[model samples]
Target: MSHAPTHVTCSDVSFEWPDGTPVLDGFHWAVGPGRTGLIGLNGCGKSTLLKLVAGELRPTTGQISVAGSIGYLPQDVTLATGARVDEVLGIRATRAALHAIEAGEATEANFAALGDDWDVEERALATLDQLGLAGIDLDRTVGELSGGEGVLLRLAALLLARPDVLLLDEPTNNLDLRARRRLYAAVASWTGVMVLVSHDRELLDRVDQIADLRDGEVRWYGGNFADYEDMLAGEQEAAERMVRVAEGDVQRQKRELAEAQVKLARRKRYGQKMYENKREPKIVMGARKRAAQESAGKHRIMHAEKLTEARERLDQAVEAVRDDAEIRIDLPATQVPPGRRVLTATDLRLAHGAAVAGVWEVRGPERIALVGGNGSGKTTLLRTIAGLVPPTSGEALTHVPTRYLPQRLDVLDDESTVAENVARFAPHATNNVIRARLAHFLFRGARADRAAGTLSGGERFRAALAALLLAEPAPQLLMLDEPTNNLDLASVRQLTDALESYEGALLVASHDVPFLESIGITRWLLLDGELRSTTAEEVRESRWED
Candidate 1:
């Protein structure tokens, strides 16, 4: 499909916080027509770059230029719950004008507002339906919609504007599987310039190309996320090969230099012996001595230069290879014996609805996926199961110790350091033990001393996960709610690694299907007013209309 050409250019842009925390320095990135997935590790300035382009934040040192109109959807969209859908869609005045004209009270002001388009409402409804929001009352208040619906509503507003450029930051973070598929369709149908920032693998796979932003620079790769991975793998393989070659060259240079020094020493001894025996005239002997010394100096300099060049090549080769640190924590204490009952729910009636059909039980190390539409009580159900809130009618119980990591990541104390937070969970463990375990989470030394409130989103996630998993007595039944929301793709992998080592019954409430699959969920349950058994296949195909 052909698309209108739009350009977003960042030239020598640099931005730093007021406290002198550097984010981007001399960063240069550019994107034109077609969807571009802006990706990198967490804390790599992906969102900051998008904000700068959207004019929400200004570059400290350089300039950003865009050649077309822009529509920006931020990560956390805040809307007034009391506002009407028409008001949020920015069509209230236009609707009012249409009404006045129909009432035979059309004035010049009303005509100006109405313009030439008489099918605006019809078009709005079509747009809503295209985004899987069909039949939604345009006059309904924002509070009536679910969280996922609210996000889509905001997107619908942007679609109505029909801007030349679109930027969406973590657009699918709050969306469930069905909602995500609808969003994916919308993105796929976009025929204009789009800069999408997200860690959602399925979403990234739809982009035309991938622009990896790292160390304040962008490395472009043609095609989608899978293509980018293939190209990167090839590059890494070549880099490792070059590193081996450089190492061999360095060793060879060192050996050659040593051999040259040994030969020079032997010549010096022979010359001294010849001088003592008066084998030649004194002038000839002095001439031979000067030539020998000059030759030795030149040889030494040449070998030194060769060695330096080899080492430099090695350094460059090493930098080309990525050494992503994986999270590895031993959780032997969390192990559960087969047939051991980990948790049970008896006639559980969530605060949102009626009592469930039967007694729910999780035994052994069963990993369960709790999923449903927004406002379907996924988070609320998990919270109730964790004992944070009481059920409306029945009870939920856990025989083993449990830990719940909420979507907000509120496990850490804002005032305390990362180490202190972990220590809070493991009160009986020594400082040395806590710090050592934090290192596995990539929080080492002074990093462990940083206050939880001061950490970046990624750092804060690591700190919270460490604290929860390493808590005293080791939680044998772990429950997580939207655990991968704030993480980057790499961090998600690390999370998978950490969970792989866990040997307990796990109940995760998340919309990330790939991550759910990666962690090896043994069961799936859909919680829409009531929880029911489901399969991974059914979960992917199931649709829950808001």
Candidate 2:
């Protein structure tokens, strides 16, 4: 595909927060044409860089330049409550002007406002339809839309602008499967200078290239996310080999130095013995001893320098190998017996009007995936199972202890420290015990002391997970809603690893199919007006239409 001629450039950019913590330092990046996936671990400033390029943020030093107009969709998008859809799309004024002109009240101001956009209303509707918002009325209030639909509406607005450069940050975080497909199609069709910061594997796969941001520097890769992973694996393997070689060289140098010292000591002893035996004149013996001492000093210095160089090489080689941490913990207490019933719901009807008209039971350590579109009552159903919401009819019961990790992660207290939050759940655990277990969740030392309000997105998620999993009585049934919503790829992997150690039944509601498959989901249930048995293949192929 031929891309348009447009450039997004950053020259010697440096950014820092008010606390003097630096994010980007002397960063230089220039992207043109094709889509570029900007990726890094959480809190690595990928989103900050995009904000700078979009003019939402200013660089502490240097400048950002765009050769053409730009459009940016932020990670969290919220519209005004009273704003109409067309107003959100930024075409309301033009649409109104066109209507006025058609009504024979063609004023000079109306023509000026219309400009070349006489067909603005048609184009706006078309863009909305393309983004899976065809059923959305342009005159409808923004408050009437679901969260996922709101995100799409904002993207549709950006599309209506037809900017040469487009930036998206975690655009698919709230989207369901069908909405995600629409987004994927839109991304695949982009033919401009586009930069995206997302952990969505499918979305990253559609990009033309990948730009990795680490340690305040950007490294370019030639292809999409999968290609980037392959390249990274090869680099890590080579780095590991280099580390091994350097370690061996260091050991050999140390051994050679030790042998040299021993030989020097032996020579000194022989020289002293000869002098004591009066084998030569005293003055000649003393001169010979002085020369030997000088030679020994030179040899020692040379060996020491070589050892230092070798050790430095080893350190550099180790640094080249990435040390991304993984979560590893044992949850033996959460195990459930094979014949035990974990949860049961009978003819339940939720406050949201979604019905579970038949008796359903979750037994043993089954992993259930709840799949559905936005507003299809996935979260409500999870809440209903968690006992947070009472069913309007029938009964929902859990025989085992249950824990729910909500979509908003409101279980954590912002004012409390991470350790304090965990302590709230596991009051009987000692401080040392809690910290020891939190280390497995990647919170160690000072990290555990940090306040919950100050954590990054990934850190906050980890803190919440730690608090929930380490709670008193040990929850035998764990339920999570959209657990991977804003997590980075590394955090997502860590989450998978954490869940691998969990021995309890899992009832998770999410649109992340890959994540669901990774954790070994044993059953799939589709939630529309009722929960029904389904398969992963069917879920992947199905589309929800209004």
Candidate 3:
């Protein structure tokens, strides 16, 4: 993967939104042959850089060049609901042309359309299968497929295009475990110039190198995500040591400056005494006074300059240390007793009559991982349990106070500030208390006053998560569906840290097994047309299949 040559170049590129929000400024990046993982914080230009490289969005200034054909898969793929699978795969025309030629009515245009690509249908189906999209028939509409399947279908289209350069943005965002494996395999097999932007740690670990896009510049780490982390850890440790050394220098300079001032004061006093006592000739005394004064002034200036330089060095050294703050949540109200009944469901069935069968229950603070394949109604089940919708023929009852954070994250009122949103959730709590809790989530002071709508993806997720968890009356049962969908690595870590502090029952429906494990999942349940208990190992091995 690391053996390929450079295939892309961006020279002095700059981009910003129409509202003049700057994303990139004079950014220059070169895409070499091999897989490169582009990663950064949520608001950073990872996605935007991918777009610029793919020519989907032109740079506001400068130029970008790609050596060959490009195939791009965007983060948020919007498929035409009525469009057929084959149509979305971009082979409908070729298929139709091939069929026409087979029907003995081969027109010139039909033959031209099918030129050299007679096996397009076979290739399309093969690519779809490669991405774990085999069961989906060509006639099936986009609306029929699950969210994960739709993403895979888009990827299949890109693969079918067979471009020299491939750009994928969060390709594994909605994929199930099995689907993720398939995608990972595809990524590993990719040998061309591939620039992938994702927060999926597993996917990033497969890259040849890491392209960290932060503050509009790309820093290359010559290895996968794990290598980048190791290198960064070393760099941070060294930076911290430098900061300590710099701090000592600043303090020493300050002390020397203070001592110099004392000496100058004493000299001034001695000079006054010499003049008052008339200890020498008037000219000699006057000359000595002037010389002493000049020396004192020079000494003061030199000491002051030294202190300023030391402080400046200290500031630069401090800047080298990255601030990777983790969320610290302590909600005593969310705690539940070990023997308490948190949730109970009897003869559970979905509104669509999909397979949600038998008793579904959560006792005490059980952290359950609701695992299943794509389109298995996990979201619907979670929503049903949360009382967002009524079950078709069963009842889901929460014995304890409950809250749900849906995938759409519409819980936050966009017009309100973060503080206002939290206030809405925790109305009984005082503003000071609410803000104090928010500070743990890294929203401090004026940041708490920013409107939710203006927040970046990670910030919005944090706000929504904060609001859901901090709801009034203290939720004892928390349901989250695809909570890690758009979170960056830091946000994901913060979410994990916050979950560690949660004492409530958790039912998180996510394909993120590593994340689920990190949060200490006590039980794993596979959801299909029916629900049944499963072990973590089985859940992983079978892809949550029955």
Candidate 4:
């Protein structure tokens, strides 16, 4: 497989946006027959590189060669509302021509359209079944499917093409646990050269190798995500050791330079005293003083050069260490007493017709994980608790202030800057206060001044999170729906770090089991037609049924 004639090759490629913002410069890459996981921070061009390889976007300067046909499944899958499943699969015309020929209307046009695929329908159905879409009707419209189903449908279409090279970009973004499992199975069974860009840790754990895209370059790592982490941990340890050694060398150089200067000053003072006391002749003393002064100048220059070299080495050492800043801020005002009721839903029935027949009370700073499949009213439940949706039967009450972060992250005004958005949330806070808080979210100075609309996916998430957490009332109760959907691993880690300092009650609805576990969830409630208490193991083992 290593010598499979390079299924895809990108040589000296350069890509830039229309406004001259560079994404990749002089990049080079090649992939053979195997599964490769592409990972990086947000805005690092993982998706853009996939687009270039799939021919959706062309590189401004270099050449990309493909050995055969290519198939691509984009991050956001959108199909025409009126188009049928078969049409989206690219086999509608072929199926029609085959049917016509079988019905005794074997015209030259029908025969030409049929081509060589005599079992097109069967192949399409098989591909759909392989992706867990067995029961889906080929005649159904694309608009009739749920978001997760739509993503799977797009993957099904790609599989039907049977291309030599395949690319998937965040294929599991909207998928639930079961759907993600199906997609994972598909990825494991891929035979041709495949490259996938995703933040899904479970999915990435199945790849043959990892290609870390950072600073416009790809660094290859053998084995899966777990192996990559182990390897990276070793490298970081070595880098940190080097940094410490370099720091010690710099301090030693400074001390030696200071001692030399002090000794030279003492010698000059003694010479001046001897001259004043007339211990030697005036001409001889003058000559000795001049020689001493020249020698001191040379020694000072040598020490200064040594110190400069040591400082340079220290700078290089620091650069070798990865200094990815994390979000660290205290939310002291958000604290709730152990007995204080944060939220209560008593016989609540949502305005959307989903009902919770029992009373549910959240006390203190409890972390709740709301688990459910797609279209299961998890968002509605959170919205109801936050008072965005009114209950039809009973009340959903919060004793303290509450904030809801929707899945789309529409909490902030797109036209406003990050600091301005935070100010909008906390009208009483001063400009300096807002800027200081924004810095904790990794948006320092001018970065906090950029409009929310221009921020990348991860930056926008951080801004929205900052706005919510730093509000005037301080969000004693926070509700988040799928907060980790499109965030890269680094951003997810930052979110986890930020939440670590929050003392408020948390109610997050997400399919990310590892994230939920990391946040110290005290309760797990499964949302179907009713609110049912569950556990982490149960959530992991349970599968969605059709």
Among all candidates shown, the one with the greatest TM-score: 2
Compared with the true structure, the alpha-carbon lDDT of candidate 2 equals: 0.92
lDDT leaderboard ranking: 2, 4, 1, 3
Model 2 over residues 406-489: C-alpha lDDT tens digits? 989999999999999999999999999999999999899999999999998899999999999999989999999999988989
Off by over 4 Å in 3: 1-6, 354-358
Q: List per-prediction Cα lDDT, in the order shown.
A: 0.90, 0.92, 0.88, 0.90
Note each model's CA RMSD in angstroms.
2.2, 1.8, 2.2, 2.4
Pick by TM-score: 1 or 3, better one = 3
- Over 1-546, each residue of candidate 1 has an lDDT whose tens digit, in order, gives 224467999999999988999999998878899999999988889999889999999999999999889999999998999999988888988999999999997799999999986888998899899888886898999999888889999999999988889999999989978789889999999988999999999999999999998777899999999999999999989999999999999999999989989998999999999989988999999999999999989999999999999999999989888877899889999999999999888998888773565798999999999988777888888888888988888888899999999989998899999999999999999999999999999998999999999997877888888998999889999899998997888888889999999999999998888899999999998887678888888777765433
Question: Between the candidate structures 2 and 3, which one is better when assessed by lDDT?
Answer: 2
**Model 3 C-alpha lDDT per residue in residues 1-546, reported as the tens digit of each score:** 133354999999989999999998888888878999988899988888888888778999999988888899999999999999989988888889999999997799999988999888888889988987778899789999878888999899888887889999999988888888999999999979899988898899999999888767888999999999999999999999999999999999999999999989999998999899998999999999999989999999999999999999999999888776889888888899897889888888887666655666688899999988887889888888888888878788899989999988899899999999999988899999999989988999999999999998999999988888888888899999988888899899999999988999999999887788889999988887788888988866764552
TM-score per model over all chains = 0.95, 0.97, 0.95, 0.94
lDDT value, candidate 3, whole model: 0.88
> TM-score ranking from best to worst?
2, 3, 1, 4
Worst 10 residues of 3 by lDDT: 1-10
Least accurate 10 contiguous residues by lDDT in model 4: 1-10
